[model samples]
Target chain A: MREDKKTPSVRKLRVRKSHIKTRLVLFLLLTAALMLTVIFAQQICPYDPNAQDTSISLQPPSLEHLAGTDRFGRDMFSRILVGLQTSVLSTLCLVVIITVAGTAAGILCGYYGGILDSVVMRISDVCLAFPGLVFALAIASLLGGGLHNAVFALAVISWPKYARIARSQTLSVKNTDYISAARLAGGNSIQIIIRHVLPNSIGPILVTSMLDIGTMLMELAGLSFLGLGAQPPTAELGNMMSGGRSMLQTYPWVIIGPGIAIFAAVVIFNLLGDTFRDYLDPRNSRRN
Target chain B: MEPILTADNLTKIFDEKGKEKFTAVDHISFQLYPGETLGIVGESGSGKSTLAKMISRLTDITEGNLFLCGKEITRVKGKALRRAYEDIQMVFQSPAASFDPRRTLGDGIGESLRNHGVSKVNVQKEAVRLLKECGLSPEFADRYPHEVSGGQCQRAAIARALAIRPKILICDEATSALDVTVQQQIMELLGRMREEREIACIFICHNLGLVQSFCDRLLVMYEGKIVEEGTPDEVIKNPRSDYTKELIEAVL
Candidate 1:
């Protein structure tokens, strides 16, 4: 009877393990494919993304132009490929900046809390208090219309969320017995923070950053859509959508193509992030 | 013989500037000579763990002096404080929580050796040897804290604490979380280690019965103050203070 009960449990464990493995592998492959396309955007484009061909202007999807042609007669497919490169790369840069800076500030504050911690935490509160997009809009306009400025604006508003996550995570991990043990083992503050505190606290921070990818992508696009980002001739998804908005009804393909790209990018990253969270979640892994 | 560790009127006040200040360890003093096992028994919130923490320098000493082999370490900071740790080590109540969940048992055991400039290869060899000395299998060195049983993890924690060969070992309710059988096993292991190495120990636990056999001397604390001190048999058989009498009655 015990063997009968144990056999199913052992099989269940194997099944759960493989289920986690397969989903993780699938999403990882999809993310890799998306990154490769973005990296080789320029080389892979059949037609120059910025070049105009007036004779083919407003043409719908055809064998020659996969996503139809815009009013400027630029191939929508080629523009989208290049636009993805810009959007994805900028979002990646923004995520890296905030994750590194916010994590550093948080770990220091949480580990060695003093006047500096209170001051930085309050500043982050102020940043978080503002509506994210509106603040980004205000900063983007103040800094002038460009992709870099929009990213900078978004970065300023986005970092506080990461800081808050990292801070809370650090606070929880700080009091764990291992931290006390590390101190007893002759680890200095910096050594303790790097070895004991960071490793233990990093799980939530990484998941938050992964989930932020899609939100950052959308926010970046939102800024560009408002004319405060990626000025004309720069193939950015949001700018392309803005450029083709007026012709939404007459030549809907131009607007619809980039909209779909944005949607696909957002969905892909969000799902990947979700899967990554599931994979890293200890509760789920430990169940089997 | 000169005491290996000494605490002189050590006090710890939480939120000293706040209106509602709380004294965790108040004007406490004790001494641990080499090869001695000093057990501190107190009820919950009696500041037994706080006393351990202050002695090990994990918590800052709000006032008074702490000496290790005649060296004052009360105001030591930074690298000096870290260097002071070479003579003192601690094992906490929850053994599983005392090892980094991300690191293997070997890494946690060898961490001090690595920090003290031991070569990577030697640290690994020493860690494995320590694990063996602590009665854990060699394969257990590669396991994470969560992967091992509580008794096994506690043994690993003991191994890590002994890695640097510190003069003093502080076990703050180290076996309180384990089952009765496992607790006895750990106590035996601790006794064997102490006898083999002559490392002075400050064993903090609330269980009067458990410490009676293991400790040479016992200090009964009440509300952060030492209420009574004697050898385990003397205190348990003939308590002096009212609180110690009450404690002994409750246990009996």
Candidate 2:
């Protein structure tokens, strides 16, 4: 009986150490790739994304333009690199806004939990009622098309999800023994929420934010496709695809180039998010 | 002896769904004189824990009052309410569940001192001292809840409750989750603390034998009411209430 117990515990310890190592490796690789992409964006791409050559318009893949020329004679590969920057930038902005706004709103509603909670949640419900695309389009139309406006539109629609998650987490954490202990020690409401509630609830919030980044990127691309995102000459993926679609049959590589960029970006973020969810979730970590 | 804490007709009622109103604590009254241990004993649904919660002000009284150091706590609000909290601290049943697993045990204990505006240096020193008193090494302060054993976690929780040096310490099934050996040690520790600090305590538990040894006085609760109250010797040797006798027999 003693050996049986000892063996399982030893195995569990090994598994836990390996899990931590896997997480560290994945985190480092993903962050390094993202950083490098941003740092060397301009140096790596040979063609100026905005500089068009009418003479080489509609040319197929060649040494001059590796991914070939678009209908406007702009190099598709260069524009795709610039498009990576725009997509990553917009998604980063959206995540920051959602993380800050959603977490704060969630903490307030969850900790206080009364008339204020009802009021805040009802507002979240109203926002959630609208389909994501419709909400984004409406906000973009109102704010007018630009990089900042796209980010604002995405953030406005995205915050409700984080708020709902944060609020639920806060409600559960506020009742924990640590919270009561804090209160009994003469810690006021603000002190209790900040010290006890937020730390416990942040793990889930972080996992959700990681997953939200992928969805935010997709939404930004969709909005740009509809002419509601980045304007012309801005070199966004959606705009590049839109500009390439007209001659897609003659030059398939034009759409293919930007399509690959979007696919890689989304897949990488989703994988990282899934890995993070597994690592940070207490239940999952405990099981391992 | 002057009472450090007293509950006069303390009651708490919860409005259940439909027309049913559940009385969790019904007109229960008791007193904990300085340096005395009053054990509130009952089964799971008997409201012993509810009574302890009221004494600690974890739950508000519905129709009665509580006094700490001669001040009425039922109507106390704002700064007065916060000030009242410093005199009373609670140790919960499941120490692991009570604390945030993300935080270190040291931070949890130091937070209590920090909240009352104690200096950072003093809070750390006191936290270390309390941990040591609870039979924990100072190194345990830097570890998260998951890193420690259940008994050690409970000890850490007790240290956190004692950090303020409150006049009253309320244990809501504090040792029930521990093994028999650990439970005995915890009971002995409480006895030692009561002797050294001269602090009043309300020990809430369902185990009659456990309280019989630890408590000076015992109050028997039944369905949210204090059916019987007296010294442990009197209550155990010559039980007056049928429910009290049955509870004692059932546990024995």
Candidate 3:
């Protein structure tokens, strides 16, 4: 037979930029730096985060106290560093839980459809109905003040978006003939879902989850700022901001330190999410 | 001789919101003897595809019974369901959409063979052999569906259908989506495969000329019901219904 009748399908997969290698790498590097700083936060900062250092209180940025000192005589630089660690970790936990739970809910409903879909989707609708941040605030406050409570509240509020995305993505995929062919190939519902649906829907869900991590971080900071997260003495970016708000005029270093950390962390995560969304989404690609 | 496949009073009704209702396929019955190609021809929304899906157990049958090899399969479930699927396979119109984009064409072709108990190591090699049988190179099996032309993808699809060793094959407007020349090539390939196997085939399409030329018998469907059924020559020489006459006239 004429095997060379065509160039063959492999050649079409040209070694081009594809979807997200470069941008994903850049974002990943920025994220790794922040994560590493968080992982080794104590070694990165020399001062005791909670220790009273009245001797250096209100001192502007200097070689000794890089972020000066706060009103309580605690080191601002150390506090901000530790705060970032708390904020990022909490957000990571929240997004992981939300994405997992949401994607599961979406796939189940989308696969089985009918009454199960009705029940899960209605619950998703109810969750999506109210303002997500407000709902999170309510849940966090009701659960009492703590970092875990805020993460829990954030997860509860965030899962529906992922559920909606997963469900919709699954819906589109389930209609394709490959899925029917898989079914015809004697694949059970779960096999079809795990082998086919999951891989196909994961890209968008991941993109959304990455972006949501940034949002969750911001929300956690907001909750801590409002006194609903990160109890006193525990360094957290929002908590530091709250502590420095009163000393904004005299101890500008305190506010400045935490603000920059939060801003950079959120930007890196958001950029990563946007880049992934663009790269992973077939609609956004020109080659397709 | 006993028919290899039979559908009795098969029907499908779409009840939108329990108010607006439409019947996609009415009580339609047909019999396919072994090694016969039975064509169901009509315009779009003529229920030919719905019929194919119902027989292949892809779509839920709202009414009537299905008989394959003399066993009633009105409600296929559990292990029996899997057995039923192996007995029959369907090729969709959109060849590219019928194969997973993330996987190689070999994966798609080998899926049924693996399901039918072929070992993993040999499935790829077997799939390559099947690809060659379909007039494609072994390398074609390694490429994704989009990497090949429509005709090539359709060949891969047929190779996949053959992998299951099905007694009955359903082609749901399979060649309708291809270029006219590609359609002819796929038709020619399908004819060769039919000649070499004892598989009964159901060709669902809107192309009257293809049905008349390729199929042993033609069943004309209109608005969810079969308006006429006979050998192609019988229908072509002596049209029994206005719908059948009009369909032939349109082809002329």
Q: List the residue pairs that clash in candidate 1.
A: none
Give one digit per residue, the lDDT tens place, for model 1 in A1-288.
Answer: 999999998789678767878988998898999999999999999999989989989999999999999987899999999999999999999999999989988988887788989999999998888998999999999999999999899989988877887888888999999988888888888899988888888888899899899999999999999999889899999999999999999999989999999998998899889888888887557632
Docking class of 1: medium
Better of 1 and 3 by lDDT: 1
Tens digits of lDDT, candidate 3, A108-220: 99888999999988888888888988988899889999998888887887788888899999999999999998988888787789888898878878877888878888988
TM-score rank order: 1, 3, 2
Model 1 residue A245 lDDT?
Answer: 95
Query: For model 3, which pairs clash?
Result: A83-A236
User: After superposition, which runs of candidate 2 have C-alpha atoms over 4 Å from their true positions?
Assistant: A1-31, A281-288, B17-19
Model 3 DockQ vs. reference = 0.59
Tell me the tens digit of each residue's lDDT in model 1 across B207-239.
898999999999999998998998999998888
Model 2 root mean square deviation, Cα atoms:
2.9
Backbone clashes, each candidate: 0, 2, 1
Candidate No. with top DockQ: 1
lDDT of 2 by residue, A239-262 (tens): 788877886787799888988888
Q: Rate the local accuracy (lDDT) of all candidates.
A: 0.91, 0.84, 0.87
How close is chain B to the truth by TM-score, in each candidate?
Answer: 0.97, 0.96, 0.97
lDDT of 2: 0.84
Model 1 alpha-carbon miss at residue A234, Å: 1.1
